[model samples]
Structure formats: C-alpha cells, structure tokens
Target: MSEPQYKRILLKISGEALAGEASRGLDFGVIGEVCEVIKECTQMGVQVGIVVGGGNFWRGVKDGAGRMERTRADHMGMMATTLNCLALADVLEQMGVEVRVQTAIEMRAIAEPYIRSRAIRHLEKGRVVIFGCGTGNPFFSTDTAAVLRAAEIDADIILLAKNIDGVYSADPNKDPNAVKYDFISYDDVLAQHLQVMDFTATSLSMDNKIPVLLFALKDPKNILRAVMGEQIGTIVKEEK
Candidate 1:
C-alpha cells in the first residue's frame, strides 16, 4: 500500500453535514458512510482529529442568541456539539475505530477535558480524537474552534467537509453563473467575501499558516481522497 500524504489532519465537520439530506438532527446513513471513510483513513496510518459543529442542533450567533444572553446561548451550542461528537464517537467505535472524545468545556461525566498533550498522545496511539464544545467561549464559531484545535495538535492540514464540492465565486445554490475555484488564497477569500467559513476561522488559519481543504461530504470516498492529498476540492492557503 502507498503511504498517505499527510501524517496528521484535523477534520472539521459541520453538524449540517452529519444531518445529510435531512432538515435537521442526526442522519444514521450519513454517519455510517462517514465512519467507514474515517476507518479507511486510519488504515492508511493517518492520525485524525475531528471538530464537529452544532448548526443542526443550534447556532448561538445566528440563532436566537440576539435575544438571549450571548454567553448562555453559546454554552447551549457547546452542549449541542458534545451531543454530536458523542454520537459520532459511538458509531465510530462500533465500526471498530478506537475513538476518544475531548471537549473544551469540562464535561467529566461524558468526555475528557481538552488536554493538548493527552490529545496528541491519543493520536500517537492511532486513536481518533474528536473535539467538541467549541473553544469554551461565547461568540466563537466551531470553525474557529477546529482551527484552534488544529494549531494546538500541530495538525498538517484541516479537512473542511461541507455540503458543496468546493468554494465558488458565488453561492452556487443561489446563483446560476457562479464559478467553482479549484484553489483559493485566504486573502482572496476575505477580499471577495466568499462564504466558505467564518472570518474568525479563516483568520486563525492564516495566522497559523495552515491549509484548509473544502469538499463536499456527499460521497464517502471524498474523505479518503482529501486525506490522501488527491485533487478533490478547493485548497485554502496563505499563498497562491
């Protein structure tokens, strides 16, 4: 078997991706397929870390956080992320993948607290580390949390699995003339205001000089392709 392209990677999966075609909540079919793909990545000797969003369950910033106390709403969103991570971890373990969940917040009963050294140790043991609960702070998106975790773990790159195949000049679903970009720079992304991820997340990635690959989560094989460094999606980087 050929060697994998990256030694370690952080996969940022949105809660919406876990929901698949459904309007909301977990989608077992998608979960199974995603786990299968992750299992394949493990076989290739790649240390994987996952950061899941809570959009399906809740979105503090875009949701009713406007009316509610910002901190409380964000805390609720964090709990929602923990729920998603636990479900994913359970499915992954059932699929024969050794998985450990770590949350930014202190949730001793359900998961271990986010310990940088411990997380790296788990990855070294060939275990998948699932990061939940965002950054343990309000007014922060899970995308930023993913990058923060990636920086902490020193991951080689971030795999941003989204609903679309890649970044576009405009929202493809909304615009007919939108064009797809095979690769884009972080500066252009900000200058053009392309909606790939939150500004905070993109800025963090740029500050750390980490690359992010954006791809559709529809086909499970795409996960393997992205991890294997295949040309599957748009690569967001600091340079052209």
Candidate 2:
C-alpha cells in the first residue's frame, strides 16, 4: 500500500454525496461505505476532520429563500447540516472510529459546541471531528466552515469532495469540452470566479495557504487514495 502524504486532513463533502443517487435525504448504504473508507485512513494514522453540507435537506439560497427571512432560512440550512453531521458521526462510531460531532449553534443535547481547541485535541487523540453548522452564523457557506476548521486544526490539506472528479474551466456536467486542471492556483480560482467553493471559502484557503484537493466522492476509497497522494484529483494551492 502507498504511504499517506498527509498527516491530517479536513474533508469537505456535500450532503448530496451522502444521498447517493437519490434527489434528497441520506442514503444509508452510501454513507456506510463512506464510513468504511474513512476508517481505512484512521488505521493509517491519519487524523480526519469533516464538514457536511446541507444541500440534500436545505439550501438557504433555494428559491432565493422565498418568503422566509434570510437568517431563518440560513438557520434551517445550518440545522440540516447538523443532521448530516450526526448521521455521519454515528456511522463512524459504529465502524469503531472515534468520532465527535461539534455544532456551531450550541446544541448541547445532541452535540458539543464548536470549540477549536477541543476539536484539535480530538484529532490529536485520533478522533475524527465532525463540524456542523456554518460558523455559528447566518450566510456563511459550509464551504467556509470547512476552510475555517482546516485552518483552526492546522490541517495539511482540505479534501473538497464533489460529484465531479476535478476542477474545470466550466461546469463539467454541462460543458463537455470544459478543460480540467490537474493543478490550479487559489488566486487563479478566485480571479476566474470558478465555483469550486464560495469566495469566502476560497479566499480563506488562499490566505491560510491550505492545499485544497477537489475530487469525486462517488468512489468509496477516494478519500484514502487522496491521503496517500494518489493524484486522483485537482490540487489547488497558493503559487506565491
């Protein structure tokens, strides 16, 4: 087996990945497979932290949030993320991987509040820390949360898992001829306005000098491969 290049990583995946082929909601089978993949990494002595998206259940921007207040809609989305985090954390625990779910909004009954030092300590103890909710505030994307967590935990890299395999000049799904890049700079990503992540998230990553690996999550073992430095996706970094 190839050795892992990274000691610790923050994996940011959309809720859609957990949904599998379904339009919405969690897919137990798919998530179970994900849990096993993550378990493989922990055994390799890699510390893992994760940020789950809420797209499968709710998105604050959906319907322009329609009639609801912006903050309320955003709160709903944050709650949805907590649901995903809880589900993922439960599965990881079942797989014998020590897991801790931290919520930004302080849901003491279900999860511990997001404390940077505590989360880092968990990772140091070989526990996977699952971050839910978006920085305990409205309007911040989970993408931003992922970057923030990576910075706080001093992670080596951020695995930005998506439905597609890598970063492209245009939407790969819609534009067949769109060019894919094996590597791209964070500055270039921002300048081109690539939708790889929200601007706040991308900027945060750039400023912190965190390497962001954009890859497909459909393959169950991609996470392990990524940590092993398999070059299975596009790597984004700061050139300067």
Candidate 3:
C-alpha cells in the first residue's frame, strides 16, 4: 500500500450522510461503516480531527426561517451536531478506536470543551477527536467550523465526505448536465458561487493555504483512498 499523502487531516462529515437514504435520523449501519474506515485511517498512523454537521436533525437557517428566533434555532442545530458526534464517538469506541468529542458549547458531563492544544494532543495520541457544535455561535456554519478547526490544528488538508461525489457546476441531482470538476481553485469556487463549502469556509481555507478534498461517502473506504492520495475527488486549492 502506498503511504498516506497527508500526515494529518481534518475530516468534515455531514449528518445527512449518517442518515443514509432516510436522510433524517441516525443509521447505525452507515455509522458503523464510516467508523470502520476511520479506524483504518488511524491504523495507518494518520492523525484525524473531525467536524460533523447536523442537517439530518435540524437546519437552523432553513428549519427556523421566520418560525423562531434565529439564535434559538441555530442553537438547536448546534445541539444536533453534538448528538451526531456522540453517536460517532460511541461507534468508534466500540470498534476499539479511542475517540474524544469536543464541543464548542461547553457540556462537561457529555464531552470536553473546545481546546486547541488538547485537541492536537489527542490526535497526537492516536485518538480521533470529533468537534461538535458550529463554532459555538449563531449564523456561522459547520463548514466554517471545520475550516476553523483545521487551521487551528495545522492540518495538511480537509477531507469533506459528503453525499455528492464531487463539486459540480450545478447540483448534479437537479441538473444532469452539470459538469464535475477534478480540481478547482478556491477563488474560482467563490467567484462562480459554486456549492462547495459556503463563502466563509472557502475563504478561510484559502487564507490558510489548506486544501480541501470533496468526495462521496457512499463507499466509506473512499476515506482511506483519499488519504492514500487517490485521485477520486474534487480538490479545491490555490492555483499558484
């Protein structure tokens, strides 16, 4: 097997991926498979930090639009992410993989508070650190939180494991003719208004000079393949 291309990575997973075809709740079968891949990455000695989204349970901006206060709705979304993280941590532990869940919003009984040095230390010790809660604030997204955590930990790259295989000119599910990009620049993504990460997340990654790899999570082994530098996804980075 080829050695891993990156020594450390920040993996961003959407909660909808965990929901599988149901797209609204936890699916242990999918979760198990994902954790299996995560375990393989760790066994390869690649340090990983994860940031998970909560779209399956709640979407603050969409669900709460005009129905409730934005702050209240966003807070619910944060909680949803924490729930997802706990689930991942549980499954990882069952697989004999040491895992730690750190929340942006403090929850002493359930998980540790977000601490950069501690998170890095956990990764160094071979523990998978799952970051929950979306930047501990309203309006900001899990995408931005992922970039924030990646920059904090000095990760070599961000692995975005999503339902879609890669970046498309348009939503592939909606537009059959949408073209897939094997590689793209962060500036092009922003200028074209592509649906990769939100503007904030993309800008943050560009500013930090961190590359992001977007690939489908359908085959959990793709995670391992990505670390092995397989050209199986759309890579977003600076051109020069």
187-217 in candidate 1: lDDT tens per residue?
Answer: 9999999988889999999999999999999
Worst 10 residues of 3 by lDDT: 167-176
Q: Candidates 2 and 3: which is better by lDDT?
A: 3
Cα lDDT, model 2, residue 93: 87
Model 3 residue runs over 4 Å out of place are none
The C-alpha RMSD of each candidate to the native structure, in angstroms, is 1.0, 1.2, 0.8
Residues 1-240 of candidate 3: C-alpha lDDT, one tens digit per residue: 789999999999999999999999999999999999999999999999999999999999999999999999999999999999999999999999999999999999999999999999999999999999979999999999999999999999999999989999998889999999999999999999998999999999999999999999999999999999999889999995
The whole-model lDDT of each prediction reads: 0.92, 0.91, 0.96
- What pairs collide in candidate 2? none
Q: Is candidate 1 or candidate 2 better by lDDT?
A: 1
- Number of the top candidate by TM-score? 3
Model 1 clash pairs are none
Candidate 2: tens digits of C-alpha lDDT, residues 9-73? 99998988889999499999999998999999999999999999999999887834668898988
Candidate with more favorable, higher lDDT: 1 or 3: 3
- Candidate order by TM-score, highest to lowest? 3, 1, 2
Per-structure clash totals for the candidates: 0, 0, 0
